[model samples]
Target: MRNEKKKSFYQEFEVFSKRTATSPFQHQFCLLAPNEEVAMVMAQENFMRREPVADIWVVNRKHIRTLHPEEKRMLARIDNKDYRTTKGYGYLRKKWRQYEQKMLDEKEILSWGGDKK
Candidate 1:
């Protein structure tokens, strides 16, 4: 087997999917295949067999640009803007409790535009 030749056409891919219409797209796993077509076919039978996947995305790893170790060290560290975070806002929840009302959390605010049940 030492003299055997391998096909370079098979590429690494990142697979992401969502289980339902309202569910966010999540990273399921990775796979190696010749192309997107084969990857989709394989993913359907091999990966999504037990889960209800509403969508499928197959992206080649080479096409994705990622930060290098040196780049990470060069980047500046920064604190998150307080307005963009949910922490340090527990006081709002306590205030709502005084009125016997539930607090509108991040999830509740984001679901304002979602279809009603």
Candidate 2:
């Protein structure tokens, strides 16, 4: 049938793009296309018209491997990441004070050139 043939012609694709070179690629949207070439063109025309796009990637949905909700529970828990944060090094403030030196916090680092201290 004509409907069945049309359905077979199109496949689902996941679109990802980034606005800047240093930024991570983020998912834009999903679309149906006959092939990767058409998917790229379609994405370019549809999304590129809205805002700036640094890079674009079109991937077939079938090609991507993802973990199901139940499988996610089997993954290791890594919530303890305070060591990577400024607050985790709070003890350093006391150490620096002993030497009469200031320990620059996040607030001071961010406000470097805004106002004169």
TM-score of each: 0.58, 0.60
Residue-level lDDT of model 2, residues 1-117, one tens digit each, is 999998899999999999988999999999999999999999999999999989999999999999998999889666888889899999988887765544355557777768765
Q: Candidate 1: list runs displaced more than 4 Å.
A: 1-4, 78-117
- Reference-based TM-score, model 1: 0.58
Error of 2 at 9 (Å): 1.3
Off by over 4 Å in 2: 68-70, 76-117
Task: Please state every model's RMSD to the true fold in angstroms.
Answer: 14.3, 11.2
Q: Give the alpha-carbon lDDT of every model.
A: 0.80, 0.91
Query: Which 10 consecutive positions of candidate 1 have the poorest summed lDDT?
Result: 1-10
11-67 per-residue lDDT for model 1 (tens digits) = 888998998888898888899898889988888887788878889888888999999
lDDT for model 1 = 0.80
- What is the clash count for each candidate, in the order shown? 0, 0
